[model samples]
Target chain A: MRIKKLSLQRSGLAISLGALMLLGACGKKVAPPPPPAPPPEAPAPTASLSATPNAVDPGQPVILAWQTTGATDVSIDSIGPVDPSGQKQVTPTDSTTYHLIAKGAGGSQEATARVTVNSNQGMQSTSNATEEQLFAQNVKDVYFDYDKYDIRASDQGSLQADAQFLQQHSNIRITIEGHSDERGSTEYNLALGTNRADAVKNALVQAGISGSRIKTISYGKEKPFCSVSNETCWQQNRRGHFVYEK
Target chain B: MSNSVRAIYRASLIFGLLFLLAVSSSAQDWIRTGTGLGVERVRLAAADFKGSNSDAKNPELLKTFNDVLWNDLDNAGIFDLVSKSFYPLQEPGQPSEVNFSVWSTPPPNTSMLAFGNLGVASGKVTVQGWLYDVKNTASPQVLGKQYADNATSEAVRVIAHRFADEIIFRLGGGIAGIAETKIYFVSERTGHKEIWVMDYDGANQQPLTKLGGISLSPRISPDGSRLAFSSVTKNGWEIMMYSFDLNRVVSFPRFGGMNLSPSWSPDGKLAISSSRNGYPNIFVMDGSGGNSHRLTNDQGPDVSPTWNRKTGSQIAFVSGRTGLPQIYTMESDGTNVQRMTDQGYAVSPNWAPNGQFLTFSWMRKYGPGEPGSNDLYLMDIASKQWVQLTHDSGRNDFPCWSPDGRHIVFQSHRSGGDQIWSMLADGSNVKQLTFKGSNTQPNWSWK
Candidate 1:
């Protein structure tokens, strides 16, 4: 009878242990650890620039077009900052290179276009020519009447020659320097000098030379080619001298 | 300290205090007694200043100060400075040490005496100057001044100038002396012509503008704060302004083509010549180069406008209306035109401070085969009566007036090349101010 009572008590303790283990397993099932995270992504963008009708006569306008994608800011050299995709008209005196830069969160991308200017006078063949050579062969000083800015009939031939040379060498730039004799006041002579130079420039434009190829300056009475105070010397001083750009 | 020695020092200090008080109270009663319309220069003597300290530097500095003071008084045009050899053997540095009989004796026989004491210590300079009227035996001292500054050559020269100006003011019939004023000019010393400044006596000369190109026609503002000039840049000749206070080139907007020859109005408005409208003409703009309005509309050039400081309404300029440039005066609005120079070629007119006369460069015999020589002339505006100030003195031009209206500073080619010169308003006391390379276009300071 004592052995039978011991077996019954042992069975009861086993059943209670089994019930505690079952409750612990159910709580573990309600909350579990999450899976590992995925890797990060990489960023990117695309941009390009192009010029249409890349070559043209001097003073003729050229159109510049650009395109970009996913860029926060975009800019073209000399054209300043611009929209991502745009078109612009430019009239450049010389051959120029346009570079476009597009910036984004990831990085930046760049592209370039070159416009080759065609000279009307085949100046590119003599790109390494000196100013003295150009001035001596193609251009000559134009004379003006005393205290007058009007282009004299005698100087018309010289202006015609200058215009022809400029039309042939479209890329070449020239400065029309006006000077006056030391007979009048220094300040008044300066104004007269300007008028003389402007007259020459206008004559060149009328002769089919582009105005963009010409610049004007007046030395007044300050700078005289002839220092003698005679009419013969004064006539030489009152002239529109030509200077060629390299 | 010994009791006897201390008692003696206290008694001397009290006596000194009482003497200073008497001098201070009597200083205001002293008045200049010379007539302004006299040909006689005030005879004066400048004694070597006593050295307060016998240090090595003190003697040299004292000599510099004394020499500069003597030279200043000698060149003032109003003084007959006594030679040092004829001065009294005793060089009295203070009123107490001066003996009236010694300077008033036959050899020097000076009407006035200037004496001072100078010292340098601890990198500082100190001076005590006194001007004594030799004829007034009872109250011999006419002026007393004390100056102190950093112990430098410039400081010493400045102290001497200040002392000399005081003496000139006291004896120059209430005329403010130009010793402390400056002369602005253009110098080609540095290869390129640039603006430069010097003392009125041409002592300290230094370049003010280092612009790498040509600069001309420097005109100082009435307040002496800005210098307006013309400079050549890549664009062409443009009017430029240099602010003395800022010590840099200030922005003066270009009004387009070939702006040149800027003259400041009495109220600081700029009167500039511009070719913006295809021809050069006089235009007035605000000091900051805004609010521009055409003052003259002639087809010929109208430039070099100088304002009448007395009345800001009138302008004197060079007009080429009658074929050749001549001096003309008109209202500020370009109305009521009247020609001052009837026949000769005249330009660069500078109105006097009192506005009663105009000084300009005129060639009496202008035109072909004429013996034309540019000389300075003074014209009475009301009567048109003119007097030639310079007689064949080699192409003198750009005459500017001193503040007192007693002297004129001008540029002359008398010495082979262009140089700056000054003379009395009556064409006496001609003195060369600049001897350096090719200096021209002198504009005296307003003060």
Candidate 2:
């Protein structure tokens, strides 16, 4: 009887252990599946840019409006960082493309709006078209480095472009204004800007453009393209901008 | 007995004359260096003036006169102004009304006293003012003057300023007081940068140029007849002259290619930075902008030329021929080129009227990631020892000397925007001169 009792106890222990294993299997089955691997793609950023009066006479004003979705940052090509959705009045001196970039968690999306400044507005189609357009739509501005009047390697292309336009339009007279970021004394900056304007003029003259056709002025931290006191804004301000006189 | 008595009296009379001469010469010596130049200040009392007339304008005119007189004396920077609380109960308007004991005692303890009276009658204002040495009880009065002008608040202020100046001249050595001087500066309150003028103490501010374009560096001609400034016009930057006598922008010969910062010599010659030839260089021209002779020939730009107003023999200018802008001095004829600043960036070297010191703005430690500031500094021309004038004040530049050589006016960005501020020559007693929108580049009149 003792042997039978011992055998009964052993069988009972085995049955209990088996039941524990079955319970562990049931718990595993009840647990939720590893949260479906977060969808590999977050919502991508979207951007749309438009320019009212896409075709303009030289120096005429145009409004650039842009909107973006899922964007933490938005910036324009020539202009600096701006609101995600806003409009800015720009007076482009030449045919230009404004590239807008919207960056977010997913990726960066870009959209562009082209403003076709009609340099041949009066010369080509109609006699009454816009005599005052000034060949501003033809030439481009050359930018320089900080506190430096020397032409930069990056800006060589711009100077070449400006030289090409001037060479084609022999009748155009232009003024290149040298500007500075508001970091130095006004008097000193004035001198710096003059050097910058002269640098550009010398380059154009070297490119076979007549020295008589070009004039230069140093605005010297007085007139600013942007006034936000940041590197981006300062980069825009410290430039040699071109204006058409005749 | 009669002859002896007469001889004794004559001897006493001669002794009195000698004593008076000695006292006067010693007083002159004391006055010479007493102009806020680290000397012990004279304890001064400016008592309220009495309204002596019953005209309807008497009370207002008296108030204006008293206020202006007090401020002018206080701004003179050579006096320990006794508080009004310590004033004697009875304000003395004339010599006879003064009680010397009350002023010289400990309660007031003043050595010099300024008192006055004002009146108005029949569209005219009249004032009588006196300065007294309270310690000299026997002959206490030091100055007594009378002024009359049209009965208006503005005229009353002028009278008060004149009276204050008279006292300052007598007591503050032979130097003329700056109370009547004018300060010309650049202001953008009208949505455009234009030249504006104000009294030395920041009163009567009005625009001098309404060119509706950007104007900078308004340096008044030494004779106060015209203003030379750089203005943006249809033909780039040009040196434009504004005639104070004609109250209009006059036709000055335009030097082409970015003419800027026209400074006038004491003899009426104008020095400007021009790029008419090619590079920006110093050009000394006539007052009419003719006889343009180039002074500096360099690839880097040279600008902001100022003359030694007292001698007119030398000029201090800024040049970037080196890596950065530095102060340089040369003869008026462009000889003896000497560099004044050794390190860092320095510009705007304005020579003091005395010609012994140069005041400029410097960034002693300049570059990216360097912690420093742009501060005004006063350097002795001979010794090259510099004293920092503005400390931790934001971007101080364009320091100009008052006509008296005892004060300096500069533009600072300390109080939010670039504003006109004036301080004593020793860099104390800083006062804001402009409270409106963004005034800068103060040039004190030569007078």
**All models, DockQ values?**
0.04, 0.13
Q: Candidate 1: lDDT of B413? A: 87
User: TM-score of the second chain in each model?
Assistant: 0.89, 0.92
For model 2 the local lDDT of residue A155 reads 64
**Candidate 1 structure quality by residue, lDDT tens digits, A9-96:** 4443343332222221112132222332333442656888888889876678999999999777676756767888999999876666
Off by over 4 Å in 2: A1-76, A79-138, B1-38
Docking class of 1: incorrect
* DockQ, computed on Cα atoms, for candidate 1: 0.04
What value does the TM-score of chain B take for model 2? 0.92
Candidate 1 shows a clash count of: 3
lDDT of each: 0.77, 0.82
Which residue window of length 10 is worst by lDDT in model 2 chain A?
A19-28
